[model samples]
Target chain A: MAPPSEEPTDGAVSPADYRTLCDLLRERTGLSFTEAKRYYVQRRLAERVEATRMPSVRDYLNLLRFQASGAEMQLLVNLMTVNETYFFREKYQLDCLVNGMLDEVVRHRRPGERVRLWSAGCATGEEPYSIAITLLERWPRVDEFQIELYASDIDSMALDRAREGVYGERSLQALPAELVERYFRPVAPGSWRIIDELRESVDFSLVNIVDPAQVRRFTGIDVVFCRNLLIYFDDLGRRNAAAMFHEALSPGGFVALGHSESMSRMSSLFVPRRFPDAILYQKPAEGAGA
Target chain B: MGLVKAGSKGTLGTAPTGAAAPEDWTALLEHADAGHRRHAAQALGDRPDAAATLAARLPREPDPAVREALLTALVRIGSPEAAAGLAPMLASEDAGLRNGALESLQQMPVDAVEPQMDALAGSDDSDLRIFAVLLAARLGPAERSARLHQALERDPHVNVGLTAAEAVAELGDPAALPALEAFAARFPDDPCVAYTVDAARRRFRGAS
Candidate 1:
């Protein structure tokens, strides 16, 4: 027996159908949409709806659910997502690294020890690449300690782009021309590819931080930069992600969240460390546990 | 030693084989390292059979992160058994555990938590009853207004009455006004009671 299709009244996505679709999107990806994005979502939704040759949005929903390859889902992710990913998105955090965190991180470290930094929700590698550039340009002790950088995003398409390491003018807006000249060479007129060495520095992977199977592997991290990502997570998801970061960090390791997001509000697992320049959260030393 | 691509996978410990047995994860719940224990609790959310074990560990678990994992796992299980496991933790003297249990209970369906609420409200401990009232308030007026109104009218503790009054104000249940007046007359000396009663009166009058 065939399922009857509920064609929307105006031959467009209905409010009920829009909510149902958005709920599915939120379930699969952490991204959410409010009524403000309805037009934008509807526009992209219309294209997919047309492209799939479904009679209506309801039928398209069935395709979205039963599609084994998840091809349509990827298209929706790429289209609906416009989260700003750019070099030096927040300069103060970089300043905190050079002036405060790195100095303190090295002071307690033995000679020639490896320092690991994990960047959760590093969308298309801009933030992690900027960190790499900061270490090379500003931190004089960059050569004294081994630095292992890992950046992860839940989006496979974004991870592919991150590995490619090419960016247009918008992604590099925060970067000074001199630094840009030093780090990247033009593959085209406006787009530039990160110099091979810098591109290879960050090992990018597809990771959803909430899933224990995916997140449990990260351990002994010295600093974690999970900026602007937890805002999408609900209470439980945020708590679990905080736990993952705490478990991953070495004793006394620091976590750098987005300027707007606070670790203290999300979980009591990490200790809040206030520096004159910036406040960061740290995994408490063994004697001190929150 | 400059920037090095240390590969994606960490070299710390061998990865556990595919789909660890529930018993394996349950044992890991007691692992000496809090991280492993935390991971174990999180992984056991997929195993309803381990809900009791997670609830049992909540009181004894020293690490906040691991205790959180236990609460989250129990919330995810969301069975009556899981709710039962969490209800006992509400009686804990440790504020963190009690609060954690409350927050987790709020995530459950009202039906799953209703039995636990009855038990907690009946507890001789004022703190436990307050916690139950807090859970009801968190669940909101639509789910447990009758219980809250009853608590306001009957519960002997001033704090419990205060919580119920606040719940009425916050939830804005006009039907709860008589209970609010009873509470107001019940505790005339406490200014907060009169203040809350006035607030609820204002909210109801405005709504009408």
Candidate 2:
């Protein structure tokens, strides 16, 4: 076997290799690398090329095509996705979710009806746990209603961190003191582990949002927190994801996006509703029909 | 014309190697399986001649994944016809498609995409104009300054003007200073527009 080159022949992916990897990455996951990220992707994946002992990016791509077992494919997915998230990263949006979204849903909910919420791209579990904390604290009778909270990410490693529910102090910066005290127990120096019941309330899974079939499994969800996820997708990916969110939501359910994202630009399926503190999308309530 | 058949081991290389007739690859787009269509679509990017053929097939393309592949091919074709076909997609209801088309157009050579600009900038639609101004800012300093100037002065849409001001701030064009001042003066109380204009002025002035 040819020894792995200390450096890529050109220290970059060839144009063809870039295209091939991009196509596969976009297909397997909704995540896309912008032109600016192309060079970054090349440098990041160079180690994989070395570890796999491929001669060039082309060779590595060829392996992905003809010979990759699921492990190699998963490795590529893990390398390309950006999973930077923290507890309460965007507190204003969470505020909207707790104060406005849940408030409206609770008022309209039928007796014993569980309020279902999904945190798509819930990297490292910060988002979902944050949601659970927000619900538990804000909803006066939250325990009285059955609550189904699902959190998913394409990165299995991140999901593992999320599953463990242990977080460093950095993830707690935006979290209010009261919520932290109430919801977590000290685990180590400057670290906290979520209380067991709070952690158990959320169901975490590996989900690629671009896969229509996988997304189809979720239906009648009352709220979806898919913030900061769609910004990376290309237009086609964004459109498809929006359609999927539309399909997954129950009538009159809400979808909250990152501050910079807007569903109006992509699809008419959701109506833009401005809350006192934030803007969100709501699937239209069903009409009186069969 | 070059062609790539995704995953054909016999033809596999850094790029899809092995010269197949262009017709053969284009023909594969008609196949029922999404994977085949995706492969063919990715392979045909270098064929500007295929733009019209690909654009025609876009609407009926049921699968979003296949549609994405087709859009990528058109953007790569970078022909005038391809740019024209791509314009409508910038306004697609899907944020992904809108962003994809916008990014693809931004990446295309200025000369190649210039043909589609007039229709976008001159249109009555504010969204398209906003998109056009954002795109123009990426076309290098001179062109960006020029478009930003006209957008601030002449674009009827306030949102478009506001977007232009933001792009000006991002580019920090010294030449745009006068326009930025005028724009800020035009909307003194409109905090959103004023913020971008003031920011651009500060950026350009600081650079000077």
lDDT of 1 by residue, B1-208 (tens): 6898757335433345574566788888888987678778888887888888998888889988789888888887888889999998877789888777877888776677877877888889998889888878765446678778888899999899889888878776689888999998889899888887898899989887
After superposition, candidate 1 runs with Cα above 4 Å error: A1-82, B8-14, B30-36, B151-154, B168-182, B192-208
lDDT of 2 by residue, B1-208 (tens): 0111112222111323453567887888888976567657766765888887787667667665567667767765767788777778876786656776786677565777887777888888899999989788767667778888899987777899898888877776677778877777777788888777767767887899
Candidate of highest lDDT: 1
| Candidate 1 residue lDDT tens string, A1-290 | 12444445565677778888887876566566777778889989998888889877877888888899978887777777655779998788888988889888778888688888888998889989999999999989999988988899877788889889999999999899999999999999999999999998898887778776777677788889988898876666777788778878888899999888998666777888887667899988778867
Q: How many clashing residue pairs appear in each of the predictions shown?
A: 0, 10
Q: How well docked is model 1, in DockQ terms? A: 0.53
Which consecutive 10 residues in model 2 chain B have the weakest lDDT in total?
Answer: B1-10
lDDT of 2 by residue, A1-290 (tens): 33455334667766666777887777667677867888778877787989899867777877877764667777777777778778888888778876777778768766556677899999899998888877777766575666788888888888888989998888888888888898889999999999888777777777788665466567777899999999988765676687667667787889999999999765555789999879999887766110
Query: What are the per-candidate TM-scores when only chain A is compared?
Result: 0.88, 0.92
Residue ranges of candidate 2 with Cα displaced over 4 Å:
A1-10, A67-69, A176-178, A287-290, B1-208
DockQ of 2: 0.05
